[model samples]
Target: MHDDHDHHHHDHHGHDHHHDNRYSDMQARVRALETVLSEKGLIDPGAIDAIVEAYETKIGPRNGAHVVAKAWTDPDFADWLKRDATAAIASLGYTGRQGEHMRALFNTPETHNLVVCTLCSCYPWSVLGLPPVWYKAPAYRSRAVIDPRGVLAEFGVTLPEEKKIRVWDSTAELRYLVIPERPEGTEGLAEEELAGLVSRDAMIGSAIAGAAS
Candidate 1:
């Protein structure tokens, strides 16, 4: 009986070890992809650490917030963004390496858009500044694709069943920016004031733009 129990325990340990190995392998794959993208000029390797540090310490999501606010207040600019996201975003002087190729996904009452880099964390540094730590995590990358609704819920975002959720996978060649629906009660607010209401999580499609306090 002792030998049999030991064998079962050993098997369990082996199973757990296998799972750990798999997780580690996934992380290594993501790192390899990041390297390749960096080499191809799709990602700035040197800037990755620097930008993350800047945003985490000094910079904020104000750049993206301004863009969203402008789009909300200016119909012509919104049209331009819809037609050519890269040029429009650049016109606002928010252009950089990873953000060279951009696409804007607008959220509507019928559909919601979520962005994720399943292979690696490709983000718009010029607009959103730097990605959050969770954005680069293995769990978020995998789960964002598999169970996006559940992931959003964890971020305190809940959508109605009638609304369809669309997840956009960011690649080395292209990145996505989510244009969250403008909140109500801001009709009288100026563009700058309106920008204050936009949040990084909202632009990431993990949360909605909350009404100004």
Candidate 2:
């Protein structure tokens, strides 16, 4: 009886170990994808570091802020962004390696947009800067698509039941940019001033761009 019980316990532990191995395998696959993309010139190693440094020290989310502000204030520019995000964003001199292919997702009173890379961390570094650490985690990669509403809630974004949530998946060939809804009570603000109200999280669809305090 003792030996049988011990064998049962060992099998249970082995099952848990197998589950952990699967998680590690997923991470390994993600790294392998990154390597393959890098070899194919889809991902630039320096570009990642540059983006991280920019966000940590200089430039930062200001690049995206400007884009968002321009879109909010200039209807023509907004149309251009919707039509050809890459060219429109490049027109403002925000072009880079991973940002070669871009699509702008506009949030409205009835719809919200969220972005995630289920396979790997494919992000538009030029405009949004380096993706947050959580964006690359397996939990986020899976949950963002499976339970986006719950994920948004964790980020302190509570959407009304009437509002629809749209989750976009990023890939090596393309990436998404969430154009947050403009805040209220700032109708007379200048473009630069409007830019100040935009935040990185807001652009990520994890938070809303509230009225600038």
Candidate 3:
């Protein structure tokens, strides 16, 4: 057996052009397929626009925004969110299939909370829609459980060795995300103003609130 590999291609732009052509071909094929299916009465073309509007107008971001507003207004409700996220989040009238068994982790100045499912892509999707791209990456799954501090450093978060790392292994039966410790300056802000500071990463436990960037 003989194995010989070329060092590299001379024109990288050639590969990029090929990819662009494939993408254009795919778009044309998809449009043609839709037309055929609609002509045969197998599909409703208008449904795609309706579905897009539903997500763009009605769903997503609303759930997390509601939760952040509630935490700012009610201390008792905030405590409930820390204790039982599924029930507490529901109390805010944000119940759905994605957050049925969601558990919340609280990040404090002394003890920070970070979440990563080293096994699968388990997350609190009810509040946060599509997980961030990195959330489903290979590096996160492998290093987070073993060297959390190292991974956190990339995101500018570092913890002392004396501080314990609490790793919660998740299951499809139970999903989780961290509730960030609030910032100092947000003290007298109203619920609406406070909601502006909340980010999905803050909820997922990779970061904390200090200043909005």
Candidate 4:
């Protein structure tokens, strides 16, 4: 069983520096506003940063890692994931805003999947927590579609020259999660143990699963 996917990469050339600057400006403004709020004792920047940090590194990605682990160990769940990701994922109690719709892209020896929100940072926050700043950057959004191989290289995921790359465009209504192939010599690991191999970048398609270990 398989889902429909895009195989051809776009031929667009050049980065949109203007768009990048605009995104950077927005971030700067947010930081400035946070500074003002902190100065007035209206908000605790440290607490806000801690919450964001937890989502970025701990809670959100751990949920996704569990899902990936289950898929690795249970064929039935994997099938469910491929057929109806939203239902299968929600069944695991990961439902939330920006995560109501989901798609799972299975990677293989011959093909790799990469996801990007070219228009804006449409990410699966329920599963992934906070989207990485790079994911929202204009350079990544545009280059991931135009030169996926190069983007992967920058992420240190250098696939074989013959391996195909597929780019998925995530939207506000739909989001994607990459199910990286299970690593070698992990045949006997339990689901929880397997989950340890999954990483935020791996699910985002920027790196290979198990690479972190």
Query: Candidate 1, residues 79-169: lDDT per residue as tens digits?
Result: 9989988888889877766435888899999999999998889987778977999999999999988999999888878789889999999
Q: How close is candidate 3 to the true structure, as a TM-score?
A: 0.70
Task: Give the Cα RMSD of candidate 3.
Answer: 8.9
Candidate 3 vs 4: which has more TM-score: 4
Error of 1 at 20 (Å): 36
Clashes of each: 0, 0, 0, 0
Ranking by lDDT: 4, 2, 1, 3
Task: Report the Cα lDDT for residue 30, model 3.
Answer: 76
Q: Candidate 1: lDDT over CA atoms?
A: 0.82
Q: Compose the digit string of candidate 4's lDDT tens values, residues 1-213.
A: 112232344347744343322335666677689779889999975777776676656668889999999999999999999999999999998885543589999999999999999989998887888888999999999999999999999988899999999999998889999999999999999999999999999999999989952
State, as a TM-score between 0 and 1, how close model 4 is to the true structure.
Answer: 0.74
Candidate 4 residue spans exceeding 4 A from truth? 1-59
Give Cα-based local distance difference scores for all models.
Answer: 0.82, 0.84, 0.69, 0.87
Best by TM-score: 4
Candidates 2 and 3 compared by TM-score, better number: 2
Please give the lDDT score at residue 9 for candidate 2.
Answer: 38
TM-score for each model? 0.72, 0.73, 0.70, 0.74
Better of 2 and 4 by TM-score: 4
Task: Tell me how far candidate 1 lies from the true structure as C-alpha RMSD in angstroms.
Answer: 11.4
